[model samples]
Target chain A: MTTTTTTRAAAGSGSGSGKSARGVAPSGKPFVTFEQANRRLKWALLAPALGFVGLMIAFPLAFTINLSLTDAFGAVNAGSSYVGLQNFADALTDTRRFWPAVGRTVAFTLGAVVLETVLGLALAMLMRKAFRGMEIVRTILMVPLLATPVAIGILWMLILDPTNGIANHLLGFVGVPPQEFLGSVSQSLPTLMLIDVWQWTPMMTVLLLAGLTTLPEEPEEAARVDGANAWQRFVHIILPMLRTTILTALVLRGVDALKTFDLIYATKGPGGGSDFEAETLNVYAYGLTFDYQEYGLASAVLVLFTLFIVAVVVVLRRRTERSAS
Target chain B: MTQAIRPRRVLELSRRSFGVLAAASVLAACSRGPQTASPDAPLRVLAINHVWTQAISRYLPELEERIGRRVTMRMLTADQLTSSFNVKLNASATDIDVMTIRPLQDQMLFARNGWIADLTDRVEGDADYRWTDFQDAPRERSVTAGAAVSVPVVTERPALYYRKDLLEDFGGAPATLDDMLDIALELQRRSEGFFGFVGRGQRSGAVTQWSSFLYSFGGDFTVDGRSGIGSPEAIAAYQYYGRLLHDAGPPGATNMSLEQAMPIFAQGKAAMYVDADAIYSNFLDDSISTVTDTVGFAPFPAGQAGSVPHNIPSWSLAVNEFSLLRDDSWEFVRWASSPEMVARLQSEGIPGARQSVWDDPATLASFPADLAEAMRVNAANGVGHDRPEVMQVGRARDIVGRPLVSGIVGEDVASVAADADAEFNDFLVRDNRQQEF
Candidate 1:
C-alpha cells in the first residue's frame, strides 16, 4: 500500500518542472517536496482521531491520575487537598479487600481466558468442515454472546438456585449432591468464570474459525499423505499456524474478563456477596467510588488496575509477535 | 503543478472545517447557558421504582396542576437511583427538583455534600404539612446536623413472616426467638425440601434486617460512639441468628439477600422469613407467591432485651439544593408528604410515616388484620435506624457484617467479631475525620 502511494506521488512530482518543485509558496516560504506535503496531509487527516483520543481517553486518565494524588471525596467538584501517595499506600497495604480483589481479578481472567481458548479452538476444529446444520449450530452459539450480560446473570441465577433451580434437580438425577453455585462463598468466583466461558467461548470460536478458513489446505493435506494421525497433524501443522489468532483471542477475552463488572455485579452484587468472595478489582473500585465515596482511593486503585491491564496486553502482544516470527 | 494546487485546496478545506467546528461549539455553548426555571419546564423528580413511587405517580397530574407546571418523574432501581444521584448531584445538576432518598443510607452523605436542600423552615413552619404528625422515629431521621433536609414518605420495619398452615401444629407463630427456633427446627424435621427460616444473609444487604436481631439481643451498632458489634450481646445475637439459619435454613443461606430469601417463603419452600414489612405485598401478590392464602405476618419475636425492631424511613423525599425551581421542589415535597396524601397512600397498602395514618382504623382496613397489627406493634417498639448512621453507610455495613457472615458459615463468631470490631473502630475514626469537611 505504501509503495503504491509513493509511486503515484513520484509520477505526479516527475510530471512537474524542477522550477515548480523549488517554487515559492503563496506566503513566500521555501517550496516543499511531495513527501513533506504528504506528511502534512497525513497529520491533517489524523488530527480528528488524535483529538478524539485526547478528549476521551487521555483527559480522563490524566484527571484520574491527578485525582489519585488528592483527597477528592464526597462530591466531584468539592474542595480537596493534595494527599500525595497516601491513597496508593493505603490500597497497597490493605490486605483484606484490595489484595483479595487483585487475586480474584487475575484468577478470573487467567482461568476464563485459558478455558475459552482451548474450548473455542476445539469447537472451531469440530465445525471446520461443511456440515448438514452448520449455520443453525453457529446461530445458536451466538445467542449467549448476543444476550445482555445482566440478563444472562439473572437467568443463570434462576437456573442455579439451590432448592428451586433445575441445576440441582439435574444433579439429583445423577445422584450427585446439591451444589451452591452462586450462593456459596467459595464457588461464586469459579461459577462466574464458568459463565464467562459459556458466554465468550463462542466469540473465540468465531474468531478462530475465521483464521482457520484463511489457512492453506496444503499443509494439512501434506501431513495426511505423510502418515500423520489426526492429533499429530493438528499439533504439528494446524496449532502452530493458529498461534497468532489464539493469542489475539486471548488478549481480547482476557482484558474483557479482567474488567468484567456487569455479570459479577449483577449476580453477586456490591462487595460480591456475603464474604466478598467474587469481588474483582473493578467491583472493588466501583464500591469505593460510588458506594463508599472514597474517590481518592478509588482513583488510586483504578490507576493501578489500568497499569496492570496495559502490562498484560503488552506481554501478550510480545508473545504473539515472537510466535509469529 | 497539481501538487501545489492540492496543498492550497487542503488548507482551504481545513479552514472551512475549523470555521464550521467553531460555529457549532458556540451554538452548543449558547444552548447550555444558565438553567433558569422556565414556566414550561417540568418539575423533574428522580425516584426509585418502589410501590410508593408507583402509587404517587398516579396522582402526579394533581401535583402538576397545583404547582402550575408539567411534572416528569423518572424511576430507577435502588442501585441505579444511587448512582444517578451521585453522578448528577456531584455535577451540581439543576434538573432534579425532587429525589427519593434513603434517610438511613444516604441522608448523611447528601447532607455532608450539601446536595440536598434544607427543608427545616418548609417542614416546620408550615402547620398544614404537620411535620410533627410523622412518627417520632421516622421524623427524627429526616434531620441531619440539626436541619431537616428531607421528609419521610415510606416507613419500613421488620416483620416476622410465618407459614400459618405450617404453624397449625405448633399452635401459632412463635412469640420469642427461642420458641421460633424450636418451631423452625421442628418444621424442618418434617419436610425434605422445606426450610424453616430464610432471611437476608448477604454481608452488606443483611445489616438492615439483622439490626432488629442485634437490638433484640440488647445491643446497638455502636456503644458510646464506638463499635458495639464486639459486645457479648452482639456476638450472642449473631450466633443465635447463625444457628437459626445454619441449622434450619436451606443450603447456601449465606448468599440469601432479600431478593433471594423472600422468594423461598413466597414459593412455600420456607416456613418463616424475617424481613422489611414494606415487602409484605410480595407475600400477598398471587402472581409471585404460591402461599398467599397461608402466609401470616407477626411482629418481630422477642429476645433477651425484648422486642426491638427497626422502624426506618426506608424512602424519603428531598429537594435538590441545586434545583432551579426550589419553591416548586418544596411544594412537591410538601404536597407528597402531606398528612392527607400519607393517609391516602397508607390506605392503598403502601405504608407511610404519618402517626395519624397508623392510628386510623380506616387506613388499617386495607392491610390484613394481623399484618396491620404486627406493623403497628413493630413501629411502636421500633428503633430509628436499621443500619449504622454514617456518611459511608455501605462501608460501615461491610465492616459490621463480616462477623454475621462468619457466624452464618459456621465459623467462630466471637473471633470474627473481635477482628471486625478493631477494623470498624479504625473505619469509624477515618469516617469521623473525613466527615469534618
Candidate 2:
C-alpha cells in the first residue's frame, strides 16, 4: 500500500509543474500532494477515535452477543459452553421478572423524559427573556444536575424518610398523611421518576434554552402581528421551529432514563426491593451479572435492551424528520 | 527526493523508537512475575469495614512483625466488598493476598468456584495455632463441602435486645415468644413513640434473622435438599413473625434492614430488637445510643420447640487461591486468626470466635457481661446457616423471604407459603440440573 501510494505521488508529480513552494522536493517532485496529505491527516486524526469506539463499544457489544448464546453462569472462569439461543428464549419467555422489568424500564424512561421535556420547556420559556437575577436562577437550576446521582439518591432518601423527613413534617401541617415513598413497592418507581425529573430537568432546560436563543424570531413576530395569542404563538411558531431540539432532549433523556442504575441501586439495592417492583431491565440485568453471576442471561437482556433503545430512537428520529419537513 | 527521503528517515526513526519503548515495557512487565508481591514484601489484605476488621487495623504492625513481612489493608463496606471481591476473584486477580469471607453466606459459593485456598492441612500442622480452641459452631461453619476454606475471625449469634427498664416493670424477661409479644404490646400501648418490636423486615436480609424464629418453631429452610418452608411449623413461624412485626413493629417495617432497625432500638424507640449479638457494642456505646444504660440482652424467646438463634461466623480470613504468595498469605491468615489476635479484638470490644479469647479474664472484663453471656447461651442452642446452605443462597433467600414479606403486608400466610414452596421446589430442581454437569 505504501509503495503504490509513493509511486502514484511520483507519477503525479512528474506531470505537474516544478514542485509547489510548500512541501516541495529539491528533485522537482512534491514531497506530498495536498490531496494525499489531507487524506492521510484525516485518517490519522480519526484512527484513535475509531479505535476507541471499537474497543469500548463495538467489542463489548460483540462479546455480549456471543455470550448471550451460551450458558456462561456463575464466576467468570466457571467454564461455560454454547447453548445457542437458550438464554434469549429464557429471557423472552420469562414473565415474572423480565417482562415486568421491561415494562418498568419503558414506564420509567417515557415517564421521566416526557415530564422533563415539559417542565424543561416551561423553565426554558420562563428564562428565555433576560432579567435581573437570571444568572442566580440558572445557577441554582444547575445544582441538581451537577450533584452525583448516588448522592442525590441518598439526599432524597433522607428527605423522603417516612418518620423524620421534612416532607412528612410539611405534609402534617396540611393535614396530609405521611406516605411510604421509597419503602412501598407501589410508590417506589414513581418516586424514582420524580427524582430523575428533579436531577435532569435542568439539563433539558439548558439544552432547550440554547435552542430557544438560536431560533429565528421572525416567525413568532409574524404570528404576533397576525393577533395570535401567547399560547397560539408558542404552539404553532416557537415549538414547530424547535422540533429537532425537542427530539434531541427526549432522545438524550430517554436513553439515560432507560439505563437508570445508580440512583435505584443506591436507594433500593439489588432486585429493586422485596417484590422487585422497581426492577427495570438495567437493574435486573445488573443483579443477574453481579448478584447471581448469570452472565449469559444478563448479556441476553442487555442485547435486547440495546435493541429496544435503538428502535425507540429510530422511531423518534423519524417523527422528528417528519415534523421538520 | 531529498525532502521526501528526509521525512521518510524521520518517520522510520520514530517508529523504531516507539517499537523499542513498547518492547522494553513488555519485558519489564514480564519480569515482574505475578501481581502478588514477593513473600518478603507487604501482604495485601482486603476486609469489610466492620468493627472486627477495623480492630485488625490497629494490630497491623504487630501482625507484620509476627509474620516477618509488611502488611497493608483495604477495608470496604459489606456491599462494596462482595461486589469487588466477586469481580476480582472471578477474574483470578492476584492483587489481594488475603480477604475476609462470610463463611455461611459465601463459603459454598467461593469454594465451588475455587476462589479460596483450602487451609485444613496447614491449620492442623501449625503447633501454636490450636485450631481446636475455636468454638465448634464457627469452626464447623468454616468448612464448605469438606474443605476448611477459611478460619473464623468474627463469630456472631443472634440475641434478643430489649429495654431492661421496660421489661423489669413488666415483671421479668419474656421466656416464650407469646410472653415476649404480650410484653412488647403492653409497652407499646403504655408509651408514645415507642415501637413494640423491630427486626430486619426487608426481604432476603430478613431471612437471616427470621431463621431463628423458624428454627424455634421446629422448621428449617430446607430439609434433605428440599424446601421446608411449606411445612405446618414453617407456616406457623411465618404467621407469628408477620403478626408481631405488623401489629407492633414500626411503620414501614417492611423496608427496615439491620441498619435501620438497630438505630430505632438504640434510640429507645423500640422496646425489643433481635439481631446479631456482635452489634451489642453499638447499643452499649454511649455516644451512639440513647438507652445504653437500659439495654439488656437475652437468648431469643422460645416458640413451639426451643429458642434457637443463629450461631454463624460472620467473618473469616482466607488466602486467595490465585495468590502466588500462598505461604505468605497463609501466614497473614494464621496471625490474624491467632488467639492473641482474637484477644486483642476482644479487648477492643469486638467479639471473637476463639473460645480461649472469650474465656480470658481480660476479654471478660472489657466486654459487656450480660451480652457476652447471652451470646454464649445463644451459641450453645444455635442453628447453623441462618439462611439456607445452598448454592445461590441469595436467590434461595429471596424465594422464601417473599412470603415473609407478603405475610407482613397482610397476605394470607398459607397461600404465600404454598406459592413460595412451589417456587423453591422449582429452583431446587433447576439448580440440581445445573449442577449435573
Candidate 3:
C-alpha cells in the first residue's frame, strides 16, 4: 500500500536506452583529445565495473528472459526441451505449489516492507534526538542485520523449540501450553516475518536515520514554531519532506523482501516452510529446480515472477512520483 | 536390576550431557569435519555420518589403528554429498576417498555417468572386504557394485512404535491394516490428544511416509519406471492413508515432521507414530521418552495380504569412481566392517550393517525388550534395501504423491490417479530417465 503512494524520484529515467549505436559509433571511436581521452580512459577503467554489472545483473536478466523460454534446471546440461509459455500456464493454474508460493511471496514482501517502513521511521525519529548509550544501542540493533540469515534461522529454531526452547519456557511462566512455532503451518509464515523484522528492522532504521539526519531542520523548526505540535510537525512537515527517502528505502528493501530466500529456506527448507506455508516465489522456483527437477515449469514460474515484480515496482515508482509532485 | 548398558550413543553423550550441549550446539557442531585432500596429502575421506563424529566419537581409536595412516574425515549432510562430489567427479579428479549417502540417493546416475569407480575388482581379492555378511535385500540397491560400489551402513526406518502399556491395556497387535485404522480411530475417541497414529502429512516428506502405507497395500513406484501411481491399488491406498490422517491424526498432521511428531509421541500426546529409527534410539535414554521402557514395535501394520511397509534407506559408504583412495580406504572400511567393530556397534546399542551383529546378546539387551523383537520382525518383513528411482519418481512423488494424497482427502481418487499416471508416463522420456532405472 505505501509502495504505490511513493513516487519515483525527480531524476527522470536515468537509463540511456534512447540512443542508437550508429549515432555514437564515431564519438566512441578510438583516440580523441588527450583530456577527452583522459575522460574516456576514466570511463574505460569503469568499463570493468559496468561489464561486471552486465555479467552479474543485466546479462543474467537477459539470460533469464531467454531461460524463461526453456527449461533450465540447476545443471546447464540437464536435458530440457524448450516449451514456450506452457510453464506459465502450468504454474498459474494447474499447479498448486507454484501459485500458493506466489501468494506467499506477495504477502511476505508486503508485510516486511510495510512493517519495516513504519518501525524504521519511528526508530529514526527516536535516534535522531540521540540518548544515553545511543551508540551502543544502535550497535546492538545492527547485530541482527549482521548475522547470517541461515544462522539466524537456526538460532530461532532453538529459541522456538517446543519442549526445551526458551520461548516455550517463557510462555510456560505465564501458563500457556508449549506452542509449536515453526513446525505449525498456522505459525510458520508469521514466524518467518518475525525473523525478517528482527534481522532487517535495523537496516531500515539505519537508512531512515540517514534520511532523517539529512532533512533540513528549518522546515520542522518552522512547523514547530507554528501551532503545530510534535505529532503535527511529524505528520505534516517531517514525513512529507522525508517522503522521497522513505520511498527509496521502500523500493530497495521491498525488492529484497520479494526475493527473500535464505531465511525461509533456512527456516523451513525447499518446499517452502512445511506444507508450502513459507514458500515464496524464489523458494518455489528453487524447489522446482533442485527438489523435483521440474526445470521447464520453474522457468515459467520465474518468468511470471519477474513480471509480477516489475509490475509492483512500476506501480510503486509511479505512485512515489505522484506523491512527490 | 542388572546395570543398564545404555545403547551405544554415537556421541557417548548421556541424556544429561545432551542437556548441556542442547539442540543448538548439537546441530551447529554437528557439521564437524573435512579437510580438503590434495594429492601427496593425507587421504581425504568425506564421511556423511555424524560428520565424522561417529568416527571421531564412536570409532576413532580403532579407525586410527586400522588405517595406519592419518586419514582425514569430513562430515556433511546427504544433500551436501550430492552438491559437492557429484560435480568434482564430473569435472576433474576429486580427492574424496569414501562418501556415505542413503542408498536411494546413491543414484546410479553417479556410476552410470562414470562418476563412481567400478568396484568389481576391489571386492574380490581384498582380504578385508567381505560382502557376504550384508542383508540380501539391499542387493538391488548396490547395483553400482557390479562388484561392490557401496557398503550398507544401517537400516534407517520408522517402525510402528505403539504404547505397549496402552496395547496391553487394550489387547493384541491389530491383526490387519484396517484393524490398525480402527484402533487409531478408537484411540482418538478417548479425547486424548494421543492419536493411535502419527505421521507427516505436510505433503513434503509426508508424501514419502504416505508412500510407505501405499507399499503395504502393495503399491509400487515403478512399472518399468513409467510409474504405477495410477494403479487401482494405489488409489485405494492413498484414500486409506488420507482418511487415517484426516480422522485419526492430530489437527496439524499435515505439517508434522520427525521433529514435531516425536515430541507429541514422547509426551503421551501421541500414542502411535511411524518414523525413522533414529528417534527410537534418542527416545530410549528415558530423559526424552518416559515411556521408553513400555514402547512396543511391530512391522507397520500390514494390508489384507499382509504386505510389509517400505521406508527410505539409511546411507552407506560408496567410493566415487573419481576417488583415488579405494585401495587405502578399503583397509579402514574392512576394519570397520569386521565382526569386532560390529560388536562394538552392538555394545553401543546401535545396529550395524552386519546381520551377525544382530545375533549378539549384548546388542539385543541394550534396547527395550519389545524393540529387539520388532527389529528382527521388521528386518524380516520390512524393505531395508534401496529401490532404484525409476523414471520421474522424484517428480511423481511431488506431483502425484502429494497431490494424490491431498485430493483423496479433499476431492476424488480416480481422477487424481489418472492425472498422476498421465503426468508420470509423460516424464518417462529417455533424457528425463537420468540413469536411475
Number of the top lDDT candidate: 1
Instruction: For model 1 chain A, give the 10-residue run with minimal summed lDDT.
Output: A29-38
* Candidate 1 residue B268 C-alpha distance from true site, Å: 0.6
Candidate numbers, best TM-score first, in rank order:
1, 2, 3
- Give the per-residue lDDT of model 3 (tens digit) for B1-437: 01111111132334475455554554676453453443455656777655223733456555665556567777776556665764455344557776675556544555554555555566556655556666666645765535466666655554777777767756756656788788888887423245767676655556656656667787766666566778877788878877776677765455556666677677665567777554576556678777666677666677854646553346666766655566666665666556676667656666666667776677678666666666676667766432326423345455556554464245576787788678667766643546442
Model 3 residue A255 lDDT score: 87
Supply every candidate's count of residue pairs whose N, Cα or C atoms clash at under 3 angstroms: 0, 0, 15
Candidate lDDT (C-alpha), each: 0.89, 0.83, 0.66
Model 2: runs farther than 4 Å from truth? A1-49, B9-41, B189-193, B433-437
Best by DockQ: 1
Model 2 per-residue lDDT tens digits across residues B216-255: 9999988788989999999999998898887787766677
Residue clash pairs of candidate 1:
none
Docking class of 3: incorrect
Worst lDDT window (10 residues) for model 1 chain B? B4-13
- For model 2, the interface Cα RMSD in angstroms equals 5.0
Order of candidate numbers by DockQ, starting with the best: 1, 2, 3
lDDT of 2 at A92: 96
User: What is the Cα-based TM-score of model 1?
Assistant: 0.93
Model 3 per-residue lDDT tens digits across residues A1-325: 3322211211122133223211222335322222333344465568668757876898767766666677654344444567677667667785567767777888888888888888988888999996999999999988998788889988997788644468977887898876768767778888888889888989999999998888898888887777799999999988888888888888889988999998887767657644577888898887775665555676677778888889989987887887778
TM-score of each: 0.93, 0.91, 0.76
